[model samples]
Target chain A: MLNRIRCLLIKELTQIRRDPRLFGILIMAPIIQLVVMGFATNTDIREIALAIRDNDRSFHSREYIRALAASGYFRVAALPGPVAGDARQLVAGRAGLVLVIPPGFGRQLVRRAPATVQALVDGADSNFGMQGVNYLNQATRLFSARFAREVAVDARLRGLALPAVAAETRVWYNPELTSRYYMVPALMGVLLLVTTMLVSSMALVKEREEGTMEQLIVTPLRPMEIILGKLLPFVVIGFAEVTLALPLMRLIFGVPLRGSVLLLYALSGVFLLTTLGLGLFVSTLVRTQQQAMLIAAFFVMMPFILLSGFIFPVENMPPAFQVVAQFIPLKYYLTIIRGIFLKGVGWHALWRDGLILLAWGVGILSLAALKFHKRLD
Target chain B: MLARAGLAPALPLVTPAPRVWFNPELESARFLVPGLIGMLLMISSVVATALSIVREKERETIEQLMVSPLRSEELVLGKTLPYLLIGLATMALILLLGWQLFGVVVRGSWLLLGLATVLFLFAGLGLGVLISALTRSQQVAFQVAIIASLLPAIILSGLIFPIRNMPLPIQGLSLLVAPRYFIEILRGVILKDTAFVELWPNFAALLALGAAYNLLAAHKMKQGL
Candidate 1:
């Protein structure tokens, strides 16, 4: 049985050795893809258009005006002349953000009366517009805090009334709030799912097309043995790929892994099993390589990317999509990788993820095994 | 119908074209270079290798090849090298075009990129061989190759979505996919100007993956022996 497996493995290697183009793809595609992606995917959004309607010509209002301009998140495309009606034109023109400082001369501040500043934000592109609103709000809040401090100090230096309680705002996960830190880790999950499904599914289809599968079927080797022999090479290869990927990210992209390496690999094992099983199952269903490739690509790649919380948070996804995302092995795997790499959480925190992966692995493997048997029948 | 007085064709109305918006220097990368590399690799490994093996089985050429003095290694290399070299040449052509047409800079060290490419080639070749081992037909091999190529290179390598924000389990899964490492090395060398010390672990992983995969291929290639 061992010799049979070895013989099959050797035959496979010989075919690869003879194919130069495949060898090149394994080597060159990554570099080309990276170059294209690095240039195309930029998180830092620049050159936003903003319209401002200033109702008061007071020094305070002017100061606020200056603050908005200095924030660099917006470009003052137009300034309305006294009327809110003129401001409406800019918004209609699809200006991304609008600032309207209401008419309240310096008298309101002197009397300690409240003042309101209105900001109309565009939510057309949710990701971009939402981030813009957050930035605008932060800038406005800082300006208010500084102004309050100055007023209190001038009113009374030593005996200034201290607030009863101060609220401290702390952002979780990403403190600097750089998008890449969050994005790069999430991308890893997407990439893993892609490679696994593509490799495993295609492997089976290729075998069936080649007629070597017929020979193998006629041979003494069992279907289970054939599947294992096929799966082991990819699993071993995939593991090596991930090991290489980690430090490259650390050194080049500055992504840090704060968790135990062993734990990460262990979890990956379960995840790979699931993906490998999925690919094998796909292979069994389709007779032609092209059909298998298309099926795997469409069914696996698109949904896995959109719903796996790779780009948008699963929490933020519509409940229906969220429920559907649960079935994607990547959804579970993404949480595990991020938790280990960033939060450094172990089994105490990650057992759920591990269980899901194990369940997926077992489920997919059984399905694949059954499918293999069906093909024989 | 034209002879009838009422049959004169109405003159076509002239319409103005839609007003164009300002296009702000949107630099787009022509994916042909990478696309070609991916396409050729997929074809050679999954399509070509599978077809050849299937044909051999159908024609009873397998018996002749097995009995020949050529070792399994020689047979595999002989069969696989043509495709491998073609893939490499295609890669070089695409790289040249990418630079000339798109101004895509190769920021990483050339030596490191070359070494990483070699390792990645080994892995791809190994994977193709492994796929060939498991199947009896070209269709099965091609399907497997597509599955392997699509995911790891496209998503897991930080090519499309940033890897950082991915929930934890997916990240763990990516660690095992080889293309993720190759993409790292490629990106590290080309975009980040990464050094060898930084690229070594990825290279090591590729080497290990390639070695292990090839070993399995070697074992499977001599199946009847």
Candidate 2:
């Protein structure tokens, strides 16, 4: 049985090696994607174009504008002459944020009266708009505290103390909140899914389409041996992809792998079983390689990436979607990847995710083997 | 402590009152619907055109067509026409669904939007035919079609990720991606109510891309023949 499987494996590898384009796609595509996505995927939105309508033209308003620019979150765009006209910049997408400092003349601040500034935000992209609002709030709070402290110092000479509440915020794990730190680790799951699933699902379908399935079935190898043999080459390819991706992720992208490398590889082994099984299952259901490719792409890969909590947080998803997300294998892998990469947690912290992945691998692979066997018969 | 202190309470000197333009309520559906429409049209057109030529080759019908008096241009057009109608019908259906389900009404010129959709579909279908011409098997065609059309539409087109947030080099690279321009047209027409004066640049870009892809596909089809 081992000898038969070895023969099948060698045949599969030889066929794959003969196709230079397939070899290039299997090896080179992930590296290109990694480099491109490393530069492309960013959520740390900075340099938001801010248009300031300083109606007051007061020293305080100028100082506020200066402070906003100093925060490194905003750059003041060149707006039209009048405030009403400049608001068009938001619609034109020339500015993402607009601050209208009302005509307070600095009198209200000296008299300790409430003043108001209207901030018109281009909310076509709500996530970025909301982040902009949060950053603006923090900068404003900091600016107000500084002003209040100066006022308090002046009042202290006349024997008066001012009330102020200071907020000290500490962000754990990602202190600077660099988005690449989060995105690169999640990208590993996405890249692996694309390459492994594409190659594996197309494997059996290609054989059947090329009219070679009968030749294989006529051989003495059993269904289980054939299935294992077909999957083994892709398993090696998937692992090679991971090994290539991980070091680049660590060295080039600077995403730290804090957990044991052995544990990561072991967990990835279990994860590959699920993905490879999924590809095989897709192959069984379709008559043609085209159908297999379409089903694998639109049905399997799309939902996996979307629900993986790679880009959007699963916590923020609706209740029903959150439930649906629990079924996606990538969801479990993402948690393991993120936890291992960022939190540096070992099997103790991530054992549940590991166990779930193991279950999924077993369930999916068995179903695929059963389906493939029935098809063969 | 500040409220209790005798010193005048330091109230917020400047309050930020935000007004979300184009989408006042900041509805994500409004932004998503148009981009979704672009994505749907892209997948349908690309896949349909990709399979058209490859299916013939798979069934060995290309030999019959090759010996016939049909020109490559006519063959290309014949293959593309049905998918073009399908693309138009799918676009209309999605727009209707978008209005009914998401309250996404087209605010700008429908004429411009229709033109842009047609041009975008042309570019996508041309790329599909191009992929079909290059690959020998249906599997390679399908994989190439998805990889070529879908990934770029999702990533580089600003469907989910804002192009502005990407690094400068990637942002520049996005200009070659067709859906980037189409998505802009959809959002501009549907949400922002942008006029043709503001949208002419996008229109020009789509036309150029459509002509480029179709010309390339036509040239490749001739070579294959």
Candidate 3:
């Protein structure tokens, strides 16, 4: 059985190589996607374009604007003249935020009275809008503290900057919060899924579509041997992609690999079992390559990409969405990949993820192996 | 908490009163519907066309076609035109559904939307043809088609994630993605009521990409035949 499986693997490899176009695409698509996603999957939303409508035209109004700008979270994109507070800037997609200062704004501040400024936010991207608000509040607090000291006498005596309790955020493990560092590692799991699942499924369906699958079934090979033979090439291909992507992600994106390289590769081997199993399972369900591609793209790829915490964190997802995300094998693998790459944690810290992944790999592979075997009989 | 700290006289400096524009309620459906329209059009047209030629190759029907009286251009045109029409029909149905279900009104110029849709579909068909010419299998064609349409549309395009937030190089790379232009046009027309002047560049970009892909597909088909 091992000998037949090895022969089948060789044949599969030769056929894959014969089509240079397909081979090149299979090898390169994942790396290209990883690079693109690495650059694009930035959750750290900085440099929000803000349009300031200064009606008071006072030093204090300018001070508030200056404070907001100084926060490094917002960029002063435009200074529209105060009129009707028309959010054309926000509407035009030029700015995500608009700060409107009323006429009594500076006067209220001089008297140490509470003054209000209207912040017209493009709430279209609601999460981004919320972040902008959070940043706005933080900047206001910092500015209010200084203003309270100079403008309002007896700072602590009168309720001012001191909120009694404050939340100080000290970022640990990838403190720079370089989104690329976090995203690049997670991309390993994502790219692996796309390449392995699609290629293995398509390759299997192609054989069946071309009538070669029946030829294999007639041979001395066992059902398990044929299934293993069909999928093992994708296992090699998956690892090849991860290996290619990792060094590039490290050197170019500067995603430091602090964890053991051997551990990363070992865990990746475990990850492939699940992906390859999924690929095999998808192949068994579809007759045509069209059906296989559709199912793999929609059923397998879509959920993994969206909810696997590849771009959006699983924690941030709605509770219902989070529950759905939990079932994706990639989610656990993603945590392992990121933790190993960024935090340099070993299985001691990541045993839960490793066990989950191992369980997923074995469970999925066995079920798929059995299903493929039954289909032949 | 400020009072509890015993820090009296909490001086409020410029409280922010929030205002929203367009779909002021910030309905995600309004944003998502336009993007979904572009994505559906992309998948249907591009995948339809992408699979058109490759299936023949896989099934060994190309030799029969080559022997027939039909020229390669006619075969390409005949294969792709139905998809274009179907894509438009799908777009209209989705638009009507969006309007009825989500109250996603077309606030911009209809002429521009119609014009943009045709050009976008043309570009998609051209891409599908190009992908068909490139690959030898239905699976490969579908994979290439998805990468071409969906991934870029979701990530590179300002559909879910704002494109402005991407790094500079990726933002530059986004200029090459055809769906980005289409989605930009969709949001411009559906939500912003943006004038043709503002959206002219997006239109121009779509046309250029469409023309480029068509020319490339023509060259590839000639070679393929």
TM, every model: 0.57, 0.90, 0.84
Fraction of native Cα contacts reproduced by each candidate: 0.02, 0.49, 0.49
Candidate 2 residue-wise lDDT at B31: 80
How big is the positional error of residue B187 in model 3, measured in Å on the Cα after superposition? Answer: 3.7
Expressed as tens digits, the lDDT of each residue in B1-225 for candidate 3 is: 635555455465556777766667776667777877876677667767887778988899988887888776677777778888888888889899999988989998888889999999988898888888878778678778877876776677776667787878889988988778888888877888877777789999999998888778777777766
Roughly what TM-score does model 2 have, to 2 decimal places?
A: 0.90
- Which CAPRI quality tier does the interface of model 1 achieve? incorrect
For residues B59-79, could you state the per-residue lDDT of candidate 1 as single tens digits? Answer: 578888888897777766776
lDDT for position A96 in model 2: 83
Question: Which regions of candidate 1 deviate over 4 angstroms?
Answer: A23-48, A53-61, A72-94, A101-118, A144-179, A210-212, A317-322, B1-225
Weakest 10 consecutive residues, lDDT, candidate 1 chain B? Answer: B14-23
Per-model lDDT: 0.63, 0.80, 0.79
Per-residue lDDT of B90 in model 3: 85
lDDT of 2 at A29: 76
Model 2 docking grade: medium
Q: Model 2 chain B — which ten-residue stretch has the worst lDDT?
A: B6-15
Clashing pairs in 3: A158-B7, A158-B8, A158-B9, A159-B7, A159-B8, A159-B9, A159-B10
Model 2, stretches more than 4 Å misplaced?
Answer: A58-60, A81-84, A104-113, A168-178, B1-12, B24-30, B51-63, B67-73, B96-105
Q: Compose the digit string of candidate 2's lDDT tens values, residues B136-217.
A: 6675677677777766676678887778878788999888788989998888788777777777888898889877777777
Q: Which candidate leads in TM-score?
A: 2
Better of 1 and 3 by DockQ: 3
